[model samples]
Each structure stands twice: as structure tokens, then as C-alpha cells.
Target: MKRIAVLGSGTAGLHLSYALVNSGAFQVTVYTDRTPEEVKRGRVSSTQVHFGPARAREAAYGMPLWEAGPELESIHVTVGGQKLFTGGLVHPAKSVDQRAYFFRCMKDLEAKGVSFVYGRVDEERLQELARAYDLIVDCSGKRGPIAPFPQIGELSPVTTPQRKCSAGYFHGVVPLEPAGVSITILPGAGELFEIPALTALGPVTILFIESVPGGPLDVFGGIKDPESFRDRMRAVVDRHFPAVAARVDGEHFGLCDERGFVQIAVQPAVHRPYCTVGGTLVLGCGDSVVLNDPITGQGCNTASYCAEQLVRTLTEEPVGPWDERTGEAYWKRIRDYVTEVTQWSNAMMGPLPDHAVGRLMAAAADPAAADRIAGWFADPATAYEDLFRSAAGTKEQAERQGGL
Candidate 1:
């Protein structure tokens, strides 16, 4: 059997494993840092609400959209209380429980005959794996140990620690619009996202906020207790976003694992040797290679996109000298798209670009502009706009601010 080892059984690792097993040409084994149950129970931020294209990818991956309990509706957008134009931000944008959906992928892949190797991968363990498999894929995510992938090469969108994010999923909160997501951007202050989700446990609401670093959330500072976290969150909502303040309750959240405030940046080298063994190469995929700041909720979508490309490349060709080429191609295909998404994400961290603000004002005032920007989220290319087009008109924002 042609053997491939994938480190990190997260979304990218699991999805690629599923694709390869379904092909029946490769024997795929996934190595993860936690048990299947632990992996299943792991806490992740209320992070993903897919655009139509992303949902399509999920369906293609054989993740049951119906059983996954997706909430497909629309997205509502506003900046500084000025309603920007909204369109099909995600034409039928859909969401699912990150934890549940992840496990479901694992279960289906196992049923189809893929193997799971659970535990952390030290260098020696990886070497043993390298000796056995024809190829190795690192999907170890942000905290990956196998790859020393700290942000390097290009200047990242966030140089210093950027924002602190707090989030939780609630059981009830009547949405403001018809089955869509909501975004409220307070210039240079914070960003809020509310999405209705269909969890296996039941329907839940995900309310998340990102604030300017060191702004005022002292309670979230190096804290791990649930009581403290929820209290801090409630205080924040009450102080800044009082409209939905009272609805903030800890009753629904027994524990929140995805709550953390970390700096955000974008980086992926186009031609790095993922790993080498006697001239053989193992590559990094998913967030290990490219982690878009979750600022705009593109992490899952990007993971899916990379997983698809990696699957196609691994199955279609032989892994030898061309492995480097494959890695470059992997980086090439995602670089532009990620750049667009990252730029857009970085923009959310600060004051909305005046032009973007103007565009929003124009969109709210002009229906056409509203639809155009909203469409950009689902299919950026279709909008004839680059999601990463710098917020600085003409001048790249990175250069204009000389900040990045």
C-alpha cells in the first residue's frame, strides 16, 4: 500500500485523510496530540460560518450538510452604527459545531478504512513515521511542534500583539435578520459577530468580540477560570455593547475553551521544505502552513481549500524531487487568496478604511454597493475586488502606515 502519514488530526488533516481514503489508492494514517474523545471535546472559538463556496467544499468532502445541522441564511454588516450595504455575504452561508463536525469527519474516515495515530510527534517519532510513509503531511495547527513555523519572510499584518478576543455560544437569542450572521464593527475599538448555529446538542448562538490590545479587558488577562471569563465578557458587553448586554448569560456555557486574546498575523512560505528524510520530503498543510487570523472567520474555509489542494496534489503525482514543486504550488495557489483575506482581516482590527467606510455608507445608501461588498465575502473574485486590496486607497495600507 502507498502509505501517507498526516500529523495533527484537525480539520485539514482529517479532511485530507478522508479524501485519500475515499480514493482507495493510499493508506492514510493521522497522528494527533489528543485522544479521539479529547479531540472531539476540545474547545475552539465559535469560529466558522462558511460562505456558499466553503459549504460546497464541505459537501464535496462528504460531510453531511443536512445532518451537520447547518444554519444557512445571510450576513448582516455594520460599521460604527452605519449600516454598510449587505448582499449574499455568503449565499446561504452555513454554520456547524466546530467540535461535532470535526469528529464526524473522523468517524466517517475511520469507517472507510483510514487509520488514526493519536499523540504528539517528537522529532524521533516523526523520523520513524518518515521511514515508513511515502509522504507526511503536517496539519499540526498553530501550536504545531514538528514545524518551526513562526511568522517570517514578509512583514505580517500584525507586528505587535493586536487584539484580545472573547467568545461563547448561547442557547437563545432571536437573530435580527433572517437566518444570517451579524457583524458590528466599532472603529479602532472592537468587532462583534453573532451567528446562530445548529449544534448536535441543539441550536446555539455564538457571540464573539475582539478589542484593541490592552484596551480594557483586564479580567481576560492570563486567566483560565470559566467564572472569571464569563464575568469579564458580561462586563464588556454591558459597558460597550449594551443593546445585547442582558442577553449575556453564563448558564448556557459551562466551559469556554476557545476564549483567548492573541495577536493575529498571516504568513506562509511559498518554497519551504516541509521536512526532509534522506532527501525525502514531508509537507505542512492547513493552519500549520497558513493560519489566517480568525478575525474574518476564514480559518475553516481556508483549511478546507488547502485540504482540497493537498489531496489533489498528493494523489495525482508521485512524491520525489517534485515534492518541492508541489509545496511551492501549494503555497502559490493559496498565497494570493490568503493575502486578500488577511488584508481584509487586518482592516477589521483598526478603524475601517475611510474608503471602505465610504463604500459602506454608499452601500447602505446605494443598494448596489451593499450587495457588492457582501458578495465579496462569499466569492471575492466575483465581486471584481481583491479581499486583500489594502484599505489605503491607491497606497498599500501596510506601506501607508509603515506599520506592517
Candidate 2:
């Protein structure tokens, strides 16, 4: 059996480790920064809402035994505080608190007898691991492309951060009128996403604010205390989103737990996902290679999808060389998909094109158009061309395409 070293235990690493562990085709060892217990007690990392494909991958891997969270049936979009549209999805999406999800995933992997090393793997350790293992897969997330793979300039089209993100899991907010994802775009300001999610504490709401730096939405950058964060979030809602504010019970509005809130500034980037270390080729999977802005909620789903693709590529050809050529082939398999998602996500961070705005208006008036737009989140690959290109005649096209 080939020896594989998977670094980091985020969505990509855990999924890849689980798949390989069950395959019995390789001896997989996962090195992570923390153990399951540690992850459970740590602060929130991200607001990971896994769409249809991500959830399917988890179910396929036998890790879907999560406490039920809110069923995301549709997407409600508002621009500049005006209602754009509310559209239903063909397949539902779900969000689990990362602290709970990551912790449980580690324990699951451990129960399956997968080897896990706990600690950070710096350059020296990574070089040593590369020499020892037949394959070294980096799933270190936003912290790296550990093998020094050069950034893919064309693919990484952003230099400055478009949003300073503040996200928290809270109770006391009234459920959405539509009972789905409530995404409000403030145009020159940032965007706010109110989602119903399953966390360790059961069903809670996640309010993710993407503040455009130096813009009106940039308020939570200095928050450190939990109470201060919640109060400030409430104030932002009251000022910008009166409808959502009306739903928030001011007396009870706060984080779901002490560690259930996170604030970060994310600058989107992409990199060449493969590189040579100590004469052995190491491959990058997920965010280690293609980290896009989360404006469109593609981060976790894309990572899960890419990991599964890598698993298929690596295992399907058992007798192949695990060298630079193999690494390059693995990159090729996921390149287009990653690039498409990145471009589409980046496009969403800026001003929506006139045509796109018109489509939003049309969606507000037409249910078929609204459903088509909502389907973009469920299976992005299928809707990429139509969703991003032109909004011309979308109502007719949506009717013909059967509303994604």
C-alpha cells in the first residue's frame, strides 16, 4: 500500500483522510494542529454551509450522523435594503458549526484507525514528511500551500481584500420569513448572510457580515469581547437591515456560545497546487491551492468537491507513477472547476453587472427566474455559464431549463 501524509484536518484534509482510510489502498496519516477535544473547545473558525454536493460527499463517506439543522430550502436576496427575490432550491443545503463538525470528524477518523499526528508542520517537518511518504497532500487551508507552489497569477486576480468578514452563530434572531438563506447585498457596503444552521448547541442562526474595508459595513474589525461583538452586530442590523433587526430580540441577542463567533479579513488568492519538495512531488488540495473569497459561499463545497476529485484521480489508476507527472495530472483534473468557481466568486464581490441586477429584479417578479438563481448555489457548475454571463431573456431560459 502507498503511504500518504495528509496535513491539516480541515474540511479538505478530513474528507480526504476518511476516503483514503476506507479505501485500504494506502496507509494514510493525518497531521493536524489540534485534536478533537481541542477543536471542540476552540474559537469558531468559519461559517461552513455545505451545499448539496458537500453533504452528499459526507453521507457517502459515512459521516452524516449530525444533529438535524435547518433545512435550507431557498435563497432570499436583497440589494441595497430592497428585496430582490426569494427563490427555492431543488436540493437543500445545510450548515454545521465548524467547531462541532471538525471535532466530530477527527474522532470519527480516529475510530476508523487512521493515524493522526497532532502539531503544526512547518517547512522543515514538511520536507521530512515529503521524503518519508509516497504522497504528501496539503489541506492546510488558508494557512498554506506548504510546498512553495507559486501563485497562479491569472487565477488569483485580487491584491486587496474586498471584505473584512465578521460572522457569529446567535440565538434570539427570528427565523427568516422564507426559512432559507437571507443574503443582503448593500452594494458599496458589504453583504450580510443570515443562515439557519446546526451547531453543537442545536439549531441556531449564523449572521455573517462581509464588510467592505473602509466602507459603511466595516464595523466589527476591532471586536474582541463576545458581548461587545453581539451588541455591535445588533446595532449594524438595526441601522442597515430593519426587517432583520425586527426579528432579533434585542434582550436575548448574543452568540450561541462563547466560542461561536469569529471575525477575519480574507483576501482571495489562488496558487499552483503542486510542487517538488526534496525530490518528491507533493500535491495541494482545497484551500491550500485555490482560496477564493467566500462571498458566494463556495469555499467548503469547492474544497469537498476538489478532495473527492483528487481521491478519484489518485485511486482510479492504481499502477500509475506518483511523481511530478501524477501531481500535474491531479491538478489538471480540478483546475477548470476551481478556476470557474473562483472567477464567479470574485465577480460577485464587486458591483453586479447591469444585466445581473436586471435579472435580480426579474427574479423578484418571476418565481421561475428566482428558482433558477437559487439553483446556482445548489449545483454551481451547471449554472455558471448562464448565471454569470448574461441575464438577457433569463425568464424564458429558466422556464426551458426547468429552474435549477
All candidates: CA RMSD in angstroms?
Answer: 4.9, 4.2
Clashing pairs in 1: 85-370, 340-388
Q: On residues 7-66, what C-alpha lDDT tens digit does candidate 2 reach at each position? A: 989989988887787677889899988988999899988887788888888888887465
Model 2, residue pairs in steric clash: none
Worst 10 residues of 1 by lDDT: 260-269
Off by over 4 Å in 1: 66-70, 148-152, 155-157, 217-219, 246-278, 317-322, 380-404
C-alpha lDDT values of all predictions: 0.64, 0.84
Best-matching candidate per lDDT: 2
TM-score of candidate 1 relative to the true fold: 0.84
**Angstrom error at residue 76, model 1:** 1.4
Q: Which candidate comes out best when scored by TM-score?
A: 2
lDDT of 1: 0.64
lDDT of 1 by residue, 1-404 (tens): 67888888776787677677767778888887676566466665346677777777767767655454545556678776655645555367766776777777777777777788666798778778877877788787756537543454453545554666666665535555566777877776767777777665667677777666666533366657565665666676677666555555545543334432122323322223255654546777766766555667776676677777777776665655435676666666666666666556656656665666667676677766666776766764433253233333456655767964
